[model samples]
Target: MRTAQPRHYLMCRPTHFDVVYSINPWMDPRKPVDTPLAIAQWESLRQTYLSLGHTVETIDPLPGLPDMVFAANGATVIDGRALVARFRDAERIAEGPAYLQWLREHGFADARTASIVNEGEGDYLLAGEWLLAGTGFRSDPRSHAEAQEFFGRPVIGLTLVDPDYYHLDTALSVLDEKTVAYYPAAFSPGSLAVLQRLFPDAIIATDADASVFGLNAASDGYNVVLPHNATHLIEALRERGFNPIGADMSELLKAGGSVKCCTLELRSAG
Candidate 1:
């Protein structure tokens, strides 16, 4: 069933949120989040999407890779093309099949995945007339040029510094066609300057708040999932004219994600 709106987003449930152990190199793994807590958190966030009047399709939770819910990071749909992403990690390597099947069934004639190993949605940001893909942490630096060749559109690469801001969506958000929320630190200085030049009016969220991963915590055209108890940030967003909503994403955060990572905006699959 198609949604009445021009866009429909997708998300998955978390089966083993606590099973995610992001360490061995330097990433923090503050013990595993209890499984029941993860389910409750996912449900709470999912309810937020439903409340926004979006058509939500819930998928089974995949173990090990708790971040599987944020499908857009692995693949993006735009202008009827499914740009499958190359995952940088082995865990998310097998996460593209379902999205491809979705493309085939939804009537998209042209579909392809990037040949790199960057599986982070935060690394890719869709903007006016171009796709701004990020590099540094998860995405390969070369994918930018490759994506440009494949899509025929200029694929500008963003600067990625940390795993926390591994995807472009983690630091960039389109509040509307004209306005956006950004955290310059998460992106390359060059990308930041270019984005500012292109969208001077786009709201640039403070770097401190960007650390919360809430900069990407926006969707449904009128809502945002703020970290629980971020009253100041929430009020600041409202001050900037956002209708910030609440979702206790503590469990998802345990797996290094938030509201944005838990959903995929399926825009015009046909």
Candidate 2:
């Protein structure tokens, strides 16, 4: 049986959620946004974590920063050390400092902002002893070295090819310390080869599921929280003895984020 380990996560409420600007392919300002529904969906995701025995911390939402609700882009926390993001887009530049300040005041003494453009966990994901860093869109390749030095981990650089899946979290998710689920089409040929070589048993997602941001998930070893519409992934996860919990982030999808996008894992030294 797969045992679930409780995790600590950071999230932001979508109090001022809106889709006024386009940064990625998923964002289309022409579409109308339902802020109330977005908030409800976000709350459900948070409650799901709590029900699964995880600790959740919140940061105050700043107005005019609609994307701030996608807290995973805020910072990457490992061993209690936070390397806050330096967003690539001018629209989110202020977010880096805001997240850095929050971490500094809220017990992460080692928290510091990144020098290069790296969109926090949006481009950086921790899987076991390695840090899976993504580039090609929102993050700079140079930030890979910066992350390695800050977190003292072996960082493997992966290049994203699909504009729709601009962030690493959007294209892939770490299911546990060893396993991962990813959309092969979202990565470059070299990145795909690296993923296959590293995680031979990784769960591969279909275009149907990947398009729904189903790969944008969070797992506590056993329970995998993902989009409900990803039927194939849910079945595959169940076959692997994982408890796949479905979440509805359709409203947040307008802003190019979902479960994993809204979640920032807070790791501390064992």
Candidate 3:
């Protein structure tokens, strides 16, 4: 179960990518984003997943919803059960409906929709059998209870204090069923203590790597797809027997997301 094998994933083409507004600390509307470079970078990631023998599907991009390219925010799928997102911000409110429509039309017609304000996989991450849900930022803690009830899984609500690491997926990555990598400073004292207790052997990322959104990386149990700037985290992962592969997602970082943000795992149907 811990071995690396081909996985199913969903991605969105960065056709209208841009940083027109600042939702997180990493975003700056004043900073110019290279749309073409972003597209190429997203394509490279998509191809990387394909090269790894993973199935890569896509969602059609909407014109005005620039952040829709971060498909992981659209929904969180586990064993074919999709918990569609309900974005907290008004700017991204339209994205939830669009993604839900796609899921309904696709194979996920039976997927359950969310009533609570949640950012889908942006705040909810599946690590092992537990659902690690982040709060105190984009998502509400009320959504955590809702997620737990919907999935019938234990959900741990962690509070994020830093604006730079607004999302749980941005602060922590579920490398395998047992192993996780995270940035301690991004979480509150209580949340950090909880993480330490839950994952005693978790890889701790330094400020240098965390600053580059290294914890936002994704793993297929065997290999880790991370940002190229996260040299420290890359070396750390190598020490743990994981093959760390770096991707140039700097263009997408302007929108406060990286590899994991652009990729959503569609677990095999049970």
**Clashes per candidate, residues 3 or more apart or on different chains:** 11, 0, 0
Off by over 4 Å in 2: none
Evaluate residue 193 in candidate 3 and report its C-alpha lDDT on the 0 to 100 scale: 99
lDDT for model 1 comes to: 0.65
Cα-based lDDT at residue 258, candidate 2? 98
Per residue, candidate 3 scores C-alpha lDDT tens digits across 176-258 of 98899999999999999999999999999999999898988889998899998899999999989999999999999999999
Please give the range of 10 consecutive residues that has the lowest summed lDDT in model 3: 1-10
Estimated TM-score for each candidate? 0.84, 0.99, 0.98
The model with the greater TM-score, 1 or 2, is 2
Clashing pairs for model 3 are none
- For each candidate, the alpha-carbon lDDT, in order, equals 0.65, 0.95, 0.91
Off by over 4 Å in 3: none
Tell me, by TM-score, which candidate is best: 2
Off by over 4 Å in 1: 1-6, 23-30, 105-109, 149-152
**Candidate 3 lDDT (Cα, whole model)?**
0.91
Tens digits of per-residue lDDT, candidate 1, 5-39, equal 22466777777555345621223565655768777
